[model samples]
Target: MRTLALRGGARVAVVEAEWTDAFGVVTRGRVQLELRDGEPGPVLERDAGFWLRGTGVRALRNPGRRTARVRIVTPRTRTVTCPLPNTWRNEMSSMNDSGVVARTSHTSRLRGLAGIGFIAALAAMVATTLAAALARAVGVDFEIPDGGETIPLPGFAVVTGFFSVVGIVIAAALLRWSARPAERFVWTAVSLTAISLVPPLLSGAATATITALLGLHLVPAAVMIPTLARSLRTRTD
Candidate 1:
């Protein structure tokens, strides 16, 4: 039995000497199998077991931005090590030194996402405020019967900005913890946006006010969802 470590984006070719009669299990992160034609194959997640013998697998790849490990079990009593070329070893060594390279790369991605989120939030605020003003001009009274008070124009900007920040926080959390962050954020944001429409429908406001409120709610969602999702995809890919 032996363990093989693959750094992010690393690939190891399969040699008969090492892989013959070997069964591999993913112990951490993910491992992607490369087919004999150089096409991508199924990705094995943590705890998944696979056999390479008699399969047209060309190589193993770590498709994620984290280290992945695989445990190899063979019938031989001796332990075997996966041999990497000198250049690859040097690169891995540099990446392992204090983990500076990986940390800096991850931190920079987060910072970039935060910057994009802030800009999108500011734009959503301005856009929502303008839309509210236009709706008011068109005789859509921003009044709610429950409160018997008119919602001011500035209220639109403040609310939009606040919720936009919340969206950013959710996106950042997903980016840090989720494997498919962009896809998950899109689904989550869309579900929340759909839920947000309910309050306006039940606000007991006039028809024009309800319609305007629904449109206003969607305005920020349109601005923030795609912006944050795209930023996340860029970083993850």
Candidate 2:
């Protein structure tokens, strides 16, 4: 037995061997079969097995950004068997007299979600900064009574950038572990955003300043939540 690892977007061609017959089981991540005609075949999730002996499958490709692994088991003997499409999905049947069969499936795709989350974080930072600038331009003096400190423009940008990155980290973590990442991330982010508003309300600032700060708190959330959720939904492999 041996293992092969494939990074996202990597492909490995299958060549016929004279001395060994190999069957592969997806040990981690996903592997998509490439048909001999050059079209993509069904994606096999972890634990899925395929016999490479006669299957029309020309290659194995990793469909996501994470690394995928396959365990290859080769037999010392060769025997004549029925022609099986190289791109067979689901299970590999035993060719013994008993004719045993097995089948299974798995679901996950996080690399795309991480990429999208990073983009969303950048957009959220920009949007948050622009919203803060717009508020400042409209005569909102961001002076807090607690510290009597006026919030600077750079302060807004720095804070927004920091929190936006945090949002991305949260999203990536959920995608890695959560069964329903989109729903779970939305719920967690929204609850945290709500909690963040309390600090602005307790700042004892002027009503205008307090309201503007609250809106600023929301700007990053507005940009991040929907974008991350959409990516999670649309990019599931």
Number of clashes in model 2?
Answer: 5
What residue runs in model 1 are displaced by over 4 Å at the alpha carbon? Answer: 1-104
- Model 2 residue runs over 4 Å out of place are 1-110
> Mind giving the per-residue lDDT tens digits that candidate 2 earns over 29-122?
7777777899876666676766655556678898766888977766642442433345433244444322212234322445666677778777
In model 2, where is the ten-residue run with the lowest total lDDT?
97-106
Cα lDDT of model 1 by residue, 1-237, tens digit: 888999988999988567766667677877777888998766666655666766768899987778889887777746446543454345434542122111113456678999999999999999999999999998988899986999999999999999898999999887776656788999999999999999999989999999999999999999999999999877655
The TM-score of candidate 1 is: 0.62
Candidates' C-alpha lDDT: 0.80, 0.72
Provide the TM-score for each candidate, comma-separated: 0.62, 0.57
**Model 1, position 196: C-alpha lDDT score:** 93
Best by lDDT: 1
| Candidate No. with top TM-score | 1
